[model samples]
Target: MKKKLGAYLTNRKIMATALLALTLALSACGNSGEKANEGSADKETRDITIKIGYQKYGTINILKADGALDKRLSEERNIKIEWIEFPGGPQLLEALNVGSLDLGHTGEAPPIFAQAAGAPLVYLAHEPASPQSEGIIVPKGSPIKSVADLKGKTVVLNKGSNVHYLLVKQLEKAGVDYKDIEVKFLPPADARAAFEKGSVDAWVIWDPFLAAAQTATGGTILVDGTDVVSNHEFYLATRAFAEKYPDIVDILLEEADKIDVWSKDHPQELAEKLSPQLGIDVESLLLAAGRRNYGVQPIDEELIKAQQAIADTFFNLELIPKKLDINDAILK
Candidate 1:
């Protein structure tokens, strides 16, 4: 009876051990399945951060201000986007080129300059013709009347910006030597202050700042981009980022087109939305937005030729160190 009891005890211990092993094995398998699901979900969702560089102007801001873009992307791409804004084109492009931002918007000259600076940047899309967006302005009663009038006057503008070439071109077009003008290099804000204090004679800049200064200082637009140049804002990115997220690039371009079209039809509404953010008067913003041509005019051979003209001028004048090929920098 004792032997039988001992044998029974041994069998019971073996059964207990087997049950414990089975439970542990099942638990391990279950955990593995969960890890696989987690990995799959990560890939399905926005695993990689998509950084967008935006400005305070136009419909792009309006769409972004409403949080609709993220919602739009979430429904389609299942990714979360991060917006990193800049004060100007140069700064924004700088971030995009340095791998800080996946993509950004900037005027035509920046991508050229970025490529020249050996930044791994390329143009992905172009903006509509914003003729009155950037220009040279003077006080309401200032003596400066034209680009020629700035021959010996203090004119302020941001350096290495699209407006920089505009100033040069305006002078050249008017038969005024670039050096004939006392160019005071300042950002838009500081320049606005100078213009208000009657310190600077003329301010060469972009809207809605141009429009704001006009109303604030009781200033007048001496000349807009029409005379100097028609701006072509670009969507640019690093070559690697572009390839990695081609789908996102396409989406951005399409969304941009939609935004531009809507903005064109509703100028006043768009301006009101942009006013507080831009720190400009609603009336001025409305006027500027109305004047702006909002659309996506792709950069073709003709556009390239125009851009090449400005680039060639800059090269000849040694504004940029080396001559650049506009073709090598453009993507579709």
Candidate 2:
């Protein structure tokens, strides 16, 4: 009887071991299925449609036109990109302010004015100043030789632009008051026509507009912002967009860094590449390309202080309607 009981107990132990193995195998299959489903969900989440805005002069233009960013992101993730372009900073920022755009690139001045106007935008990146890119240009034969001589002449320019501060700084350096000149605000296309038609005596602008005008019209640059001011450009996003898509912003900045490096190393080559987009010759583009500071950097307190200085000058001169605290618009 003892021998029979021992055999029975041994048989029951073997059965219990087999049951444990079967239970674990079933759980493993269940987890595998759940993990596959989770992966599918992740792929669906990455199928984002972010709307980005750009200007021809910005470094963002370089990356988008070259197809580098899209190519890289598409390779790594499931995503779609939509690009919307505008002529200049003012219009580009206008789109962002109105909730029509997600991200935009603009010169320092426009953001100040836009923020003052209650545009719900915030800074994401800062491009350091390329001082030589912006300045006051007069015709080769024009008697208005100096910034001081600019007094009482109609100066055509994009209002609330980077060059606006250029004009102010130039005037101060030349011992001419900011109020000395007649300011005629216009976009680059209109300003170019006005300048050529002799509608305006002097043109305060930034390159490649400055470069194109110089090469095409033999316009002599009277002064550049490099001497007294740094016209740092900025990338901004609508608060709504920035909040919704932090990952895309990282991707943009990453690509922008690559383009910036390429632009600096191959200025002439970059000009050739950008010619079709800008509607200007590579030679002319090269002339102004050097003036552009292709530094892709994050927004910081120093950039904020520089931009605030511009705002203060504008308010003191009453260019914008009211005072602006530039730091308020910075996202982070």
lDDT (Cα atoms) of all candidates against the true structure: 0.73, 0.78
Q: Listing every candidate in turn, what is its Cα RMSD in Å to the true structure after a full C-alpha superposition? A: 16.9, 15.1
Looking at model 1, residue 105 earns an lDDT score of 80
**Candidate 2 residue-wise lDDT, 1-332, digit = tens:** 22332343345445544744655555567877555554342344376766788876678888887898888777766676789988678888888878788887888788888887889999887776788888888886999877788888889888777787778788888888776778988999999999998889999888788888998999899888766987777888988776655556666776787788788899878988899988988877898887777766766677778888888888888878899887788764
Candidate 1 total steric clashes: 0
- Which number leads on TM-score? 2
Error of 2 at 96 (Å): 0.4
Per-residue lDDT, model 1, residue 291, is 73
User: What's the lDDT for residue 165 in model 2?
Assistant: 75
State in Å the error of residue 126, model 2: 1.4
